[model samples]
Target: MYMRYFSRLMSAMAGPRPVVFSGPSGAGKSTLLKKLMKEYDSVFGFSVSHTTRKPRPGEQDGKDYHYVTREEMQTGIANGEFIESAVFSGNMYGTSKAAVQDVQAKNLICILDIDMQGVKNIKTTDLNPIYISIQPPSMDVLEKRLRDRKTESEESLQRRLNAAKVDMEISKEPGMFDATVINDDLEEAYQQLKQALLEEINVVKKVNMSS
Candidate 1:
């Protein structure tokens, strides 16, 4: 019995998990996720998304996003390659199942930085994903962050801010996410996120044990 228990424990420790981060633009989802990747070597930063947006300065293909043309994306969609796809601000974004499988194959936890709509699509899949919503400390701070980016025009910034308000309200809805972290203090937020991942893994282990 002791050996059986030890084996089970070892197997559980070796297995990978899937984590999802959902939030609106300028909510610091990407920033927090990038920090987590740097701090946790075991994490597999899933390059799950393909986008129509041109790579920003210093952004590398396959590192930031798989850059694709509109025609290629349409063909991929026709082939049912993506688990979810969405268009925002005239740019196309998609998450491919192949990307998730690539991470799982390496026995590392796959983390996705996705939007709220993409989260809904992921829920429909067989993957048992743990969702985390990264929120700004306040709308004022969120606006400031967006403006500081200097990547958008005034009209676009206003649109994003308006969208963020709606996203925050949706995040507050029951069953929308497993956990929420406010990216006000970077260290504190990262700590909370790490703790939440451990807690979810524990819950899954308990479930497996009972079964």
Candidate 2:
């Protein structure tokens, strides 16, 4: 039928999609992402974020983040050069459209490490990325992990814990994420995260081949 042909045409055009990783501080998001990058090598790439904040010690221009001046950032926003931009502590932070395109151009998965707000911001765009939330098993474990890893003061720790509480709650909402992987066990969580991230990729590949 005509409908079948149309569906196959759409499938022929299908390709890799981006991946969004959202979670709270001290959640094992970074660890899992590191493993994926290390093992898969060139299968994925990071969409470097742009920031108005001054480059920190030993930080590179495009590797760590695409550091830009406030004026430049504001101009980019006005020109619609960014997929999403937000202000934090007087610094303008954003992800450029070109940054994401760079990864896609390389035929690699564009992985974004974002907060809940960033996740929501990305949802407004046409990029329908696979959303995966890395959450701690419980608030108690989250608190302990932050305390052990970070040397921040007790007050700062409390602030982070409170923010994690909010993130934990929001992540439970239906349709907020395609998959929610609890980071209770690092190896187990990584396996789950890897599977969720790759399923979308497999679908795109299969569709392209069959079409």
Candidate 3:
């Protein structure tokens, strides 16, 4: 009976509030994510993404991303080492199984910063997560932010604007995500995200008390 109870307990604790944060290029997704990681510190573990693209200036390996060769990535994919992966702009990016495991082993909430394609793929898997999409207030505002960054060429900036349009449209789909957050106000958006993450713990506590 104790063994059975232990099994149930583990199952309950197995997927503790891992979040998949998806948004467009200039949607302040990374900004909000950094706040969570920095403020919460020990509570969240970032599953560093793997990419076949060469690192841009100031990016670090295993810190910003795990840089790998296309050949190596394909081999790892064949070996079942990636949970979800996608090709964008002729480069491969993925969340590796090892990266997730590393965070989970520490009992931290693993945060995955993936795209819409990765989000779609993850839903089919058993690694259930709270899906949240951060959206800009408007396309014009999104365009302004991208332009202000000055990090993109005109062509790349246009591509991002188009992608944002699609993302905003899809985010409105009821089943695509658990929550759609507008990032017009940074602090307000952060508060919303923080509360959502906290709710998972609250739910489990309520269940335990009743059980």
Candidate 4:
């Protein structure tokens, strides 16, 4: 069972570092993240990002995203309120500094799920987060996974594959990420992810046990 008592252990012991998760689409990043958070919900919190796009059905403001107008987002960006921002499909998306601070203030490690560009942008700031990249075993495997989803058109699938190629290559660059997890098997990959964070986990455990 999880040590539920240590919900605020991270904040009590130390200023927890944020953890950034980035990978190509269909690399199982979201799945792995879901598993981690489900098991250690108290230890991690996801920072809500801001977007200029319209919300889809069932999405809540300040929960799914801090929905904003284009003018508002642009103002925030100009004011340097965002830690990282990017324009896609004529809409802007970003993680604001306040969002990360909100999670940290709750005594939890803020988890950021972003793209390669966001990673690079964060690197310029002083957030000093642990960067982790999730990747598929190979391009062939990634292609299969995307296809198996059965949710993409041929053009969209090809576009994702193309982007994945660039993402995979960037992941290999020197010092781009602290850890690179190749998701060959779900269980094995999850174990590897936990292993990489074992030090932090143990720290939390030690703090909880001592208290």
Candidate 5:
């Protein structure tokens, strides 16, 4: 009976609040997030976003995102189903309340990796989350990182750089984020992220052990 109770508790909705990660395109958010999730797989879950854009090569529905038609997304937004939604480059993208709740139901910390606009939209909602901004060491470093990828055209690269500048500025606004992690040294940045989330991490660990 106690075991059953523990199992139920582990799956309860009272788990840790969701976490929001906002940063520029080449800010090492993915690398740091990969490390954290790999280290604590059972304790973290990524909140899959919804998008009206067609899936890219190798993208899977419900995994990379919930691919929907423009009309469907529009209807969902109209009905107040999405917690935060935005239109980017002619495609609509959003984070539905259900997506976050799905992760919470599993008693894992939900991670919302979004851009600056999405961050601003979420700020207006009642869903309280710990916002963390991952920033590159400098504009030069960010440019270098993007160049290393060699995936963007000259035009696309320039666009990303411009957007990164705006994102960096927003991240600097006082009280915008709970913690701003400048990802200069990958190891040090990971350590800082862990420290910022230490309290919540401990809670999840305790629940896991008890279960």
Candidate 6:
């Protein structure tokens, strides 16, 4: 009976896992993650981020992102509240340990939409996360999507395009990610992501059982 109860406790503690998504700007990573969240009943959506950027129109605090002032963000960093933080294009963004803990408490899989720096930080930490790279079908599609956004000036657009090129180069390196899914077809991409997640979960479970 004691052994059985202990097994049950361990299973509960293991709970849902965590996954990380990284990609270049306009790679459709966000869209694919949203779809995966909607489709997977077991997945818990953890808003694993806080940003210094002002919320866009219709964006809600805590839901879209934990909107914080730069001063506040700096303070948090000093306090070691953030698991990882980075500055991108003059904006600060980070994932807090509290944010990840909140999801872990509920036994839900937390998904982090992060950049390369954030990914590197997570790898060094205790959270053994599976990383996935969402890739655009082609540079043409990526450029078209960025143009459609209409939120960037000519200068800003050029900067983003240049960044995207660099991001793509880094993402293609061997051993960078467990899986890479091209976001050209939504349905296909989702299926691939789902399968990759299941495989990761299974590997974790096997390790747990063996241990």
Q: How many steric overlaps are in each model, in order? A: 0, 0, 0, 0, 0, 0
lDDT of 1 by residue, 159-202 (tens): 89988998899899999899999999888998898788876445
* TM-score of every prediction relative to native: 0.85, 0.82, 0.87, 0.85, 0.89, 0.85
Off by over 4 Å in 1: 1-15, 199-211
Task: Please tell me which predicted candidate would have the highest lDDT against the true structure.
Answer: 5
Task: Give the per-residue lDDT digits (tens) of candidate 6, residues 1-211.
Answer: 4345434433544545678899988999878877876765455456559999998899899998999999999999887777689898799999886787777676567788898888887776656677899989888899999999998898888888888888888889998899999989888998898888986556544654565
- Provide the global lDDT of candidate 1 against the true structure: 0.79
lDDT winner between candidates 5 and 6: 5
lDDT of all predictions: 0.79, 0.81, 0.83, 0.84, 0.89, 0.79
lDDT over C-alpha atoms for residue 191 of model 2: 84
Task: List, residue by residue over 70-111, the lDDT tens digit for candidate 5.
Answer: 999999988767767887656899998778878988889999
Candidate 2 lDDT trough over 10 residues, lowest sum: 6-15
lDDT of 4 by residue, 54-128 (tens): 997788999889999999999988876777898754679899877887887766778998888899987866667
What residue pairs are clashing in model 1? none
How far residue 163's Cα lies from its native spot in candidate 4, in Å, is 1.4
RMSD of 3: 5.8
Q: What is the lDDT of residue 6 in candidate 2?
A: 34
The clash number for model 2 is: 0
Candidate 5: pairs in clash: none
- Which lDDT tens digits does candidate 2 get at residues 1-211? 4345434433442336888998988998888988988986567889899999888778899998999999999999887777778775467888887787778766677888888878888787667788999999999998889999766689878877887888899999999999999998899998898788776556545554565
Off by over 4 Å in 5: 1-14
- Candidate 4 CA-lDDT value: 0.84
Off by over 4 Å in 3: 1-15, 201-211
> Cα deviation of 89 in candidate 4 (Å)?
3.9
Worst 10 residues of 4 by lDDT: 1-10
Model 4 clash pairs are none
